[model samples]
Target chain A: MCGIVGLFLKKPELRPQLGAHLQTMLVGMTDRGPDSAGIAVYHRPVEANQCKLTTFHANPDYPWRKLGGQLAEALNAEVDVEIKANHAVITVGAAEGSARAWITRSHPEVRIMGYGQLMEVYKDMGLPADVARRYSLEGMEGSHAIGHTRMATESAVTTEHSHPFTAAPDMCLVHNGSLSNHNNLRKWLRRRGLEFETDNDSEVAARYFAYRLGEGATLAEALEAGLRDLDGFYTFTMGTRDGFAVLRDGIACKPAVLAETDDWVAMASEFRSLANLPGVEKANIWEPEPAVVYTWSLQEAA
Target chain B: MNTIDLSKTPVRELNQRLHDLTPDTNERLWRITNLKGEHALAVGLTVPIEVEIDGHVGYYCAGMNKEAKVVITGHCGVGVAENIMSGEVRVKGNASQAAAASGHGGLVVIEGDASARCGISMKGVDIVVGGSVGHMSAFMGQSGSLVVCGDAGQSLGDSIYEARLYVQGSVESLGSDCIEKEMTPHHLAKLERLLSRAGIEADPRRFRRYGSARRLYSFHVDQAEQY
Candidate 1:
């Protein structure tokens, strides 16, 4: 039994309260999932050429500044690394591919959590409250955020095995149910040049969406493809650079509730996570139908 | 009327207070405020009292209810009145999955839509939904009646037995061994009574009845290929 929560602010003026609202939403699901927690916040986008890479290392005292200096010299671009516990946001004045290739070639020990112009991913093995406090989630600001509390049904309870699994830049996926055909699907995706970071079933789904997006399918199209291709009882809430999307399997045994107000839209495994939101009493709430792909994008609003 | 604010008082204390009331107690009316989606609120009551919740609730709001009448003014989480024995459980808003699962005897009414498995494995309770219900509803139901004013999702009443299903709207697909039967006058009368009890206004003649075909009751050599 895992719990998934996502909040997308429809109004830009409410962006500063994104993490605070998300913290409450995540902590409310502690009883549903207490093993591990993770979050991906989309905020503070970089330039068209530059990118931001969120990296995680086991050791808290890892020399992030030294790597920043070395990367600056190696790539001939200004690199900035801001440390937060075992995670760091490394901003480089270069393209995402170059920065990613440089880190993979030179610093193989550092695990890149995610890379994009506007997204920062943070995950750890602890209670949702502790992880939120460790990352100072309430004080952070973002336009949208997605969080997951995992009970670890099909994978180990490690930082690497947590949800909000990232693949393409500014894209992450969180799952609430297990997949029966992930082992075979993982093999099928591996044959198509999609590299996996963990042996977790949810990571396979994340990379599957990435593979679809890489093939030029729109977000909703990719999820529609998942309805026919993927097999399991799953309720998935995915986040990308433009917005977020939610889908449930054909059987739809897993629970998911979506609520929307004039200012924001939120989804969780239950209504308890959304009960405390502002104007939630008047928000339009409904359960997403089975095999239906629901997408919300800020670009469309723009 | 007694008012208990859940924001200041814990759910445990509220339930304990309700449990302490005797059958002949004067406090027959309860008003619960500031629910904030709390779970296991006012469950396992055997007395004939009335409970009114003012907000949304989490899972198992009125499980194992006996003679109490629990009412929720807002949406509810999963298993709203699961395994209810006797009395009535009403939700003015929508309900999540497994709304009245395995209930024995009582009336469960949802004024709005109900999610997946609305009356799964129901024993003797009668459920009336004002709006639609999601997939796999009333799967393996036994010895009760289910009424849906709106549509029903896929696989309604899979492997059902003895339970009666009446729907006024479209049924996406019926499950194995469950088929629509001729709606007789007796069924229309029973459905009219059920709708009246739930305070819903729908024509009983427009409804359809479905139940078990009794083919899968026992193993037979003629159906060996299906096995």
Candidate 2:
């Protein structure tokens, strides 16, 4: 079982309060999942041609400035870095693939959490409140964000197992229920050469969506394929650069509630997480139907 | 009236306060405000008191209740009164999956539709859905009566045993081993009582009764395809 919360600000003015609102909502779900917490915020968008990567280092006091300078020297491009706790956001003025490959080949101790234009992820093994505090989530700003608080059923209670699994650029996913066929799916994905970071089921689901998306499938198409391929009781919340989506399994055993207002759109495993959002009373609150693809996006064109 | 605001109060504290209440407590009415869909709220309440929740609630809002009456003025998430032993839990709005799953005794009423498996694995409880119900409701119901004032989704009362099902509207399809039985006078009388108790005013004659065919009770080689 886990707690998942997401918010997409319909109004640009709410960007400043995005983290504050998300912090309260995530903290409200402390009891539902007490072990670990994770959050992915799509903050200030870099230029369309540039990308940013959020990385995690095992050593908390690792010299990030030196790494930033080394990355700049190797890539021959200016890099901007911001260190938060054991994680750091390195914004480079280049394509995502080359920098990703450079980091993977160079820094063996550093693991990439996410890579995208605006997404920055922070997750760790601790209480939601504590993790949020460590990330200074209240001060962060974004147009949208997705958060998760995990209660491990099969995987180990480690930071790596914490959710908001991001296997694609500007894409993150969170899940509430365990997958029934993850072990087999893991082997299949591995055979297809999709690398996995942990023995977590939600990661596979995210990677599956990422793979489908990478193959040029739209978010809706990829999610529909997930429904056809994946076998489990899952209530998934996914975030992309310009899109947000929610889906449930055929049986829809796991709980998910959605509320949309003029100002923002929110989703949670329960209502408690959404209650604290502004203008909630007037929001059109309802439960997402089973086996339906509910998606919202800023890219209204096409 | 004892009011606990969930905005400032943790769910554990609220449940602990409800758990500490005795039948003879001085306070008779407890108002829980700003629930904001918190899970396990008022869970395991044994007192014979009444709790009125102002807003929405999360999973298992009144789960495993006993004697206490918990009313939700807003919609509820999954398993509103799951594993309910005894008590009256009322939802003013729709309920999510398995609204009264595995309830043993007492009555659970949902003013709005409930999702799939509303009474899955139920045991001796009365569930009244003011609106429609989703697919596979009462999947493994052992005993009790499920009254749906509106239409029922697919596989109503699948693999049911002994429990009686009453649907005022159309049933999408019957489950395996479950058949629409003739609404005898005795069953109609029971349906009337249930409808009246649930504050539903539909005519009892419009309703149909469904129950087990008793064929699946004992395994037979000829009925192997049914499994």
Maximum-lDDT candidate: 1
Best by TM-score: 1
What TM-score results for chain B in every one of the models? Answer: 0.95, 0.94
- Per-residue alpha-carbon lDDT of candidate 1 for residues A43-156, written as tens digits (9 for 90 to 100): 999988899999999999999999999999988998989999999999999999999998899999999999999999999988999999999999888889999998876657
Q: What's the CA error at residue A58 for candidate 2, in Å?
A: 2.0
Tell me the docking grade of candidate 1.
medium
TM-score of chain B of 2: 0.94
lDDT by residue (B35-114, candidate 2, tens digit) is: 76667888898989999988877788899989999899888888889988888999988888888899998889998888
Model 1: CA > 4 A from native? B219-227
TM-score of each: 0.96, 0.87
The C-alpha local distance difference test score for the whole of candidate 1 amounts to 0.92
For B1-227, candidate 1 gives per-residue lDDT tens digits of 99999989999999999899889999999999998889999999889999999988988999999999999998898899999999999999999999999999999999999999999999999999999999889999998999999999999999998899999999999998899999998888899999999999999999999999988844356776875
| RMSD after Cα superposition, model 1 | 2.4
